[model samples]
Target: MPSQGKLYVVGIGPGCEEMLTLRARKVLESSDYVIGHRTYLNFVRHLVRGSIVESGMGREVERVKMAVELASGGHVVSLVSGGDPSVYGLASLVAELVYRNGLELDYEIVPGISALNSASPLFGSAISGDHAVISLSDLLTPWQVIERRLRKALEGDFVIAIYNPSSRRRAGNLRRAMEIVIEYRGDCFVGVAKNVCREGEQVLVMRASEVAESGVVDMHTLLIIPSTESIVDGNWIITPRGYSRKYELEVE
Candidate 1:
């Protein structure tokens, strides 16, 4: 065993064991201490031979600090996050704390499939074109900033994938987002993928107007609002990547 310990910020990939990358699994197996949110830890608990540390939401800083301290003490640590760590995950937190404190530590970020990746296929090729992923949760980001981003992305006609569309505390945020959607692209195809790769997975493709009217969404839901040029065809949301526009196509 090495004398020095290292930190690995691992993404477990949307709560599915199969979605866990090989590097992520190796890092988890090699860890002396595995720390992460309780729900994310449960997904890879089977592969973790080390001691597991569980924390609930809003304790991200505490978890990263504990992992750092453990690593500094010569213990290899794996800080787990659901989905790709770079995308709204714990990797940035680890980096900020380490750099800000000027701590001498070795760390690596192992990427994994994000919720956007896992949820994309449920809507066919909805994300095949230019797309924007925005989280509707205004906990860290201001709602005004979110609205501005939504407006700009929709104006540019980028397919928009919304994360954290709603929560018990912020149930109206998704409605607010839909209002913006209506303003830019009215009654467009909207795909909702809930629970993603986890159990109780549900997928729905509906008109933007319908989604706005029903207001059926939650924190677990990912809403894919396709560009105005896209359309719903035979239960699939297809966003063309400009191929038909360039080439002469014939029906076979």
Candidate 2:
């Protein structure tokens, strides 16, 4: 088959049009079809002049397949995703599908700020040092593997940024992980940002033990467990870059 129109997998960045990257906005504006999850599609609905195709939860594969099929039919399709498309988003699936099906189509993965990035500013510099971005969701990855990774990250004393921490069906997952985290770093300072960069945005910073006790976290929250070395100065959190204690800065 002859080559088809380009497929731009654009990341809209944290459910806000203001946070959307310039390149991502341009790509979506020029696309012939905008495809994404219902939540993500709502973020870019005002910008999409083309056909808006959305899928329900647990229908990620269907969304990808539809985008690939549409682009294969010579439509300039924009596969929209919240946050960076390459980070646990739809870009990888789109690439994999195109490669496996031997589809002839030009495509681009436009990068955007991820949830962690959006939540970072709210927690000061807690992630200024080396940190691991781990998703607590075991829907795709096994729980055992996720536990192993958590253990390794804890052992390294690395700052950890957790995504998809909890949901209605998997409420105990975050609690279980918190147990492991406390065992390793019981007093580790934790910063939880809820609905980051969107409405109802709130930032809470407290001890890991508090997070383990509280049940406020949900799918929309982003958790940051900074190393024991991290300092909590007044209302700000900071992970120093080998700087002297007096030189450590604090900002909102």
Candidate 3:
């Protein structure tokens, strides 16, 4: 029997070539086949000299299966993802398939700069503390459970980063999320980062109550909602990480 080829689950990272990790690039270059959603494939289209296997959204299973089959035939394959592959990406799906199907495959997950990491820098000190990362997309998870998680993040005063907050079908999810947040945080401060490091990248900051009026968030948008104490200091949004005032100047 021919030895099974290696499969690389790669994270493209922020859609920026420079932001792509060296390991990810090497894996892509070394692979005999490349596969992912069409949008994600375009991120490294120019770099892929291998066979292109692109598919539309909602076809993750088909794509991963194709990659596995190709690798099982003793050909190296790279399955691509937009952000860090392990975080809400194709890595978990591949793992599930491997275990369920008993695929004889050798694979490694290559981490990339996540969308949060891409968008977080635009947030300044907003990520300097503990936080929660949640996805508002109700495709796989129930909205009720998402609501509970949102409330938990609020009650714990966690800085929240919401992924897949809204799309054409779920246009109002982010709006409802903002409403839940306002009920607890009162006047909520938020930073909405869209298409970070990509063409037409935008970062918009505003109060949660004004999200609907902001006219900026969409499916690609990642929201960094601050804790209750966070504030806008000049051009920066800041979330305090419970640091004491030991550095404060003493008064006579």
lDDT of each: 0.86, 0.85, 0.86
Write down the TM-score of every candidate: 0.94, 0.93, 0.93
- The superposed Cα distance between candidate 3 and the true structure at residue 154, in angstroms, equals 0.3
Clashes of each: 0, 0, 0
Name model 1 segments beyond 4 Å from true: 212-216, 248-252
Model 3 C-alpha lDDT versus the unseen true structure: 0.86
Candidate 3, 1-252: lDDT as tens digits: 776699999999989799999999999988899998988888898888889987889988899989888888899999999899887899999999999988768999999998888787787877777889999999999999999999999999888889998887886778899899999978767888998988889887888888756778787888888877776764478776655455654568
Instruction: Rate residue 219 of model 3 by lDDT.
Output: 70
Q: What's the TM for model 1?
A: 0.94
Which residue window of length 10 is worst by lDDT in model 3?
241-250
C-alpha RMSD for every candidate: 1.9, 2.6, 2.4
RMSD to native, candidate 2:
2.6
Instruction: Name the TM-score of candidate 2.
Output: 0.93
